[model samples]
Target chain A: MAIYGVALLAGCMMFGLIIGDLLGQVLGIEANLGGVGIAMLLLIFVTNVIHQWGKLPDSTSSGITFWNAMYIPIVVAMAASQNVAAAFSGGLVSLLAGVLAVVLGLALVPVIAGKPEPEQDCQDEPATAVASNTAGSRRG
Target chain B: MFESLIELFDEYHLIAAFAVIGLTMYLSNWLSVRFTNGKFHGSAIAILLGLLLAYIGGVVTGGENGLADLTLFSGLGLMGGGMLRDLAIIATAYGVRFSEIRKAGVHGVVALFAGVIVSFLAGGIIAVGFGYTDPVDITTVGAGTVTYIVGPVTGSTLGASSEIIALSIAAGLVKSILVMIVTPMTSRIIGLDNPRSAMIFGGLIGTTSGVAAGLAATDARLVPYGAMTATFYTGLGILLAPTALFLMVRAIA
Candidate 1:
């Protein structure tokens, strides 16, 4: 049944929340661990395991998709609560460091990729841009 | 009638906040598609609008919790709590197909480790420069450089102070917002049109929200590939920050 996805999500969420609470209790902190990350990891592992067993029907996948779409917009609301003001008011050094890390990451992208400035708009040159890694290149 | 309506507002504030947000999103999207000519994504615009609204709410109410501190918008605190934020991340990751992810190859693995370490190092160095000589504080904020969630988690586990933890979260959130807003603008300069590049890009920038939204704006097809590596990146950060990174900080501090 398509409802299987929701069932899987519910199960994962339950376990994740339990684990998060347990971790918080164990550490004596007022915060839970990454229950959602744990839940997502569980879903990924379970679905992959089901696929390996030849039991992952298409309907359940569709069900997961449905929830994903309906849920993503909630991200904006989450960003609203982020502590941007605190980051700024914390210290000039902290703010400088945050900006510096982002800049360093951005600057490292081209160096790590071994690509040049990509000046001419690579949208028209997609084939030439990524020729090194053909689809068959295996990690294993 | 007005006094009674105020009571009703207090009762359904959460639902009302959701409606107001929805309306705001539509306007942001319209502005993005029209004025920016698709240069700025609707999500990015919505985020900017959200920040502006939060700042105004803080100023008007003279209270913490931003808009949520107001009686009519109290539901936002619950709506924007950790549970939903984490769920949104998980749901997005659940939508990925494994086949596409496998194609990232050895480059993807390298990127993951590199992203976590580089981000952490950058953060740690900055913390020390700010006169945070304590290893615990440095490591907590350093972990936050890897991702916002990892920062506080590391802090709580390591028993860092709340002030340092808040700084860590702020650092992490700053990274996330930057990743979200900047990825689109710099995509081409960094060769971000392919999955391999996307995977590498994902590894280099470990903030999941930033990578997801940035990749979505740059190219929707690349979101899953970038997000997959990013998910792994966060897990690695969580595992390393409190232990390995802390030890490194301890030695240096």
Candidate 2:
């Protein structure tokens, strides 16, 4: 059953990579497109479909849960392989790109999120609640 | 006997590498709980430690592959290679439920698109600011801002040089680490207490590990919701980065 889960995952990965490769070729690019991400979508689709048919046994689902936690170690392996020195030596461009992306993204959070929900405690105090509500909506 | 044991480790370097990483994770988790009171997830610390080790490895070995350059740790290269990375990414999808994602509704969808475009523009504009004229290079770095995985995927597909690819990866790594560190601190201010907000946050952030760890630190219950959208962000980035986005960058700069 565990192997079945991995087998399913592997199958999805294969198809994903194939699609990625084809997409690259069609676009005249030399590298695979979002193979890993496609594989994830496939996995989600397959697993959802199967669950609809019947409940997947605990043992079967454990295979996936097992690998889910394994993501951390795998990512650590990735970090270990990265060339930090080379990137820093490359120029300030890399640093700037990274910092700017995150900063701008974080700033946009409020804009995308719009107004915050009214606090529960504010409801208890009628007078203060009106003032805070107005202030919150105005800021939003 | 000792020499043969050493040879065995060399031959099974991947296993040795796993052991080392396991130890690092354990220690990171311990540190997170003991010192940071779990406000910082173990994974972030582990990555920082990994990066530190990599820097030290590069300094010591003076080779391109970092710690893997040393024969004993050579397995780190393959362990960290594409095959496993892809597998890890896929495996993360196993537990995500579509029902929860649907609950995020239109806001979630909008957040995903907005997140990717904003990140791409930021990266591309910054790349331009830095004097990277080639559209391919600009797109690749921009894609990296989407996520480290997206960067290399975009870079290689667009025929970016190895140096540019490395920079993309670095840019992504920096973003991931920053998200992990900043999330908990900003959670209250951002009101990231609910699953809906977390999903939007994940979509906006667009880094699976970063969002997952950050949410884990802020509120463990929000992880799956956030992670699901974050996963989609990567897929969307992959689809756009090498195709439409690249073309737009070319036209602009």
**What interface RMSD does every candidate have?**
4.6, 5.8
Q: Per-residue alpha-carbon lDDT of model 2 for A20-41, expressed as tens digits?
A: 7787678565556556556766
How does each model score on lDDT?
A: 0.70, 0.74
TM-score of predicted chain B, candidate 1? 0.80
Using lDDT as the measure, the top candidate is 2
- Computed on C-alpha atoms, the DockQ of candidate 1 is 0.29
Candidate 1 lDDT by residue in tens digits, B1-253? 9788767778997787688678877998899999989778787777666656666676677665666666776766666665654555566557455544554546777887788888888888898887888889889888888887889989999999998888888788778777766887888888777667777888889787677667755665565566656656666677778877788879878
Quick one: best DockQ, which candidate?
Answer: 2
TM-score of 1: 0.75
> What tier of docking accuracy does candidate 1 attain?
acceptable
Best by TM-score: 1
Q: Report the number of backbone clashes for model 1.
A: 0
Off by over 4 Å in 2: A19-38, A52-55, A113-140, B1-6, B105-109, B127-173, B180-188, B191-202, B207-253
